[model samples]
Target: MSTFQRFRESWLRPILFFGNNLLSLIGGALTSASAFVLIGFYLVDAFGHGGSRNPYLGIILGFFLPALFLLGLLLIPLGILARHAALRRAGKIPSVYPRINLADPLFRHGIEVVLLATFVNFVLLGTATYRGVAYMDTKDFCGATCHVMAPEGTAYPVFAHSGVPCVGCHVGSGVGGYIHAKVNGTRQLIDVLRNRYPAPILTNDLLPSASQTCLNCHRADAWIGDKIRISTTFDDDEKNTRTRSLILLHVGGRDLTGKLSGIHGAHLGHIVYISTDTRHQIIHYVAKTEADGSVVEYTDTNLKQARVGVQRAMDCTDCHNRVAHSFDTPEKAVDRSMLAGAISPELPFIHKESIALLKASYGSPEQARTQIAASLKRFYQSNYPDLWQKDQPRIAEAASRLAVLWSQNVFPFMKVTWGTYPNNLGHNDYPGCSRCHDGSHNSASGQSISSDCSVCHNVLTIDDSNRSQLADLGVQ
Candidate 1:
């Protein structure tokens, strides 16, 4: 017989001894594959950095790669059992098909081929796993995924630590957080694929108890001292004059006993800033006596929530809600940019044109540029033909500024527009202070929160500049 036949009769013929044990060997190999994949994924997820930044990726790969390996492992035993049964009727022992032994010249190369292929597969899979983990860790994944959240990625650099991931605050610290965000993200993916996502894209559910997530680092008692409030303002496009306001809010905090106090002057060391889940708008608040031994919850009926039971505790996210995402209303952006001299102020009704141009509908950035250029040319030709004729260079500059504004603010390529994540810090954005103070809702302390502008910030002017000269622009 050939050398292969001799080897089969010797070492390979021992298959009869392991005829019933075939399943065990195959099962063990599959187990090894699964163990490798799971152990690999765990290292990648728990200790790796990539997946931490891109939450969506962690949602996809953190759970999927391990699952695939597990499924493959599970099938191995079933395959072995089926093969053994199939061969028993033929009086042949179950064994590794087309068995190759190193002593046999022709089949010896097959063993090396198997080893080499397995090695490459492992190396590549390991690299992919590491990359996936690192991608999940990136801030880009947190703020930019779902595409609608570009506003968040665009703004995170403006706030405090630029490198902090979204999960550091939103999901906080817990293994449960890791699982919850990923599972919810899967459902969100299905929705996005089916085009069934609700407007505003509500997906986060089973939010971890705020106690574990929010207060772990930001203990209420840790904050102390009065805070200086900085404010900015905008004016209507007509006259292009300033309509500024300022605030010196009494943001008092932790006192001698290390308890945060003076929250809206309630004398409660513990304050619960409550709001509607509608838009994360502050609706009403609850406060317990830091030492009074009474606990109560304050709700705002005026809050635009349809169903209740969505109350959350006050934390960094409660007030500093827009830390990662901020979109300036077009009027505000143009007004500030013009004031900053990035866009020439006298660029032929540029402020008005810029705001209008930004608000215009377009399919994409390229389309927006084309439409805005045509619209602006027509505007100057109709409204200020003489001025446009005189200051053509300034007009060009204004068009360029407006084009940049549209590109950054309106990314139609991703189906992203403006105002995706609205902040409820101020009364105008969502509900904010008005949720409680607007001549509606019940107060827990029987004390009133004011709707008057002066209550929080001094409004120097009103519908007209003459309002500033009026007699009754008084203090709160």
Candidate 2:
């Protein structure tokens, strides 16, 4: 026989033998095909003109393809082992191990196939691992996959740190963090599938250590200085009188002199508190570790219950809980729409009417949208028939804006509405700063958590009818 003929028989004979078994043949074919296809797609997506900008590319390359590749790879081994066990039981082979002869044609072919398969398996394994990890790190995997996270997914894009990844804050650094997140994610997935997740998803358990997450971007010691804030509001009056508040916020940071001052500094390294509730809204005990390393404990006079074992150190999130995924109240939402000219301020009682309509309960988002538009239109027609008839376009535009605002802030399916999640940034809307600094928590020495308004910000002007303050500041 020619050397070529001998090599062909040696190399190709055993591969054909393996293909005789339907299960093994199918599994092997699937495994090899999936690996090659995934590698090709990934290469194209990574280097192509569209790049990663296409959302579906990530879903395919990171999630679906990798999953199929892993599944096929696993099935290949199982099918081969099953086929071996069956042959042994049926007396086709004396034992599970086939006779090995280096010079034999079958043995040579088997060895070649094994080497090639091993290399293929190794490459596929690496690809699967890479894609799996990348998929889990995506925002879509976290927010879009689960219906419960729909509200967060919708709000995330408009948040201050919209560009920041969800995992950046939720998942910590290191192997332990990755494992923990995966395990938690699995549990959440199961909960979602089983329809067992809580309404208005509570994040207390999932909240990562702020020191590890928040501090990655914001340095507690960095000098922030004072921030100028101007709040504009309009009354329910005919003129839709614009009122403005000019305030200088004392956002001082750790100075060169080693003094911690202002909003961030006040609690960054000095404050710790214990809350009696799950939401951490009711703070009863507080301990301030002064710069001298002395600790002063404070207790709420009205809190008759004993302290819980849990004590949380004050962090950026404690105050800025809604920094991301913030839900605005009807009043604030209307004010913003009016300020942006989305909702016509020229309409009589537009602000008041919008607020009233938004506050009224509805069954679903669709119903809310329809009702909001109908309600607003009805108000204008009933109250000011002539105006509503003359300015139909303006009324329709205002109604459309109000409907969008309602949809953004409220999710009836999730049982999330305006004010559902308390924003701990300020005291006006929620008992945010007042939770600890309500002038109620008193130390043993009779010292209270400072409720002084000027400690954090100076009231330059508040609800000024005249635009004089704004004019002087060149803001109007």
**Candidate with best TM-score:** 2
Error of 2 at 142 (Å): 2.4
lDDT top scorer: 2
Put down candidate 1 lDDT per residue, 319-342, tens digits, no spaces: 555655566668767876787777
lDDT of 1 at 332: 65
Report the alpha-carbon TM-score of model 2 versus the true structure.
0.86
Error of 1 at 47 (Å): 24
- At residue 218, what lDDT does model 1 achieve? 57
Which regions of candidate 1 are displaced past 4 Å? 1-81, 88-102, 112-124, 140-148, 155-161, 203-234, 237-239, 255-259, 262-277, 280-290, 297-308, 407-420, 449-476
Model 1 worst lDDT run, 10 consecutive residues: 467-476
Estimate candidate 1's alpha-carbon lDDT, on a 0 to 1 scale: 0.59
C-alpha lDDT of residue 267 in model 2: 76
Q: How many Å off is the CA of 458 in candidate 1?
A: 6.4
| Model 2 poorest ten-residue lDDT run | 93-102
Tens-place lDDT digits, model 2, residues 1-476: 89955665554443444435767667667777877877677677667753565555666677677667677667665676677577768867432233245688887887688679869778777977887688778787777755688888888889888888889888877788778888998898788879988898878647888877888898877888799988888888866887888889988888888787898777766688888777888999989898789999999998876777588877778887877688898888888999999988899888878888888888877887789878877887898999988999998898888878888888888999888888898898899989888898998999998999999899888888446767888976
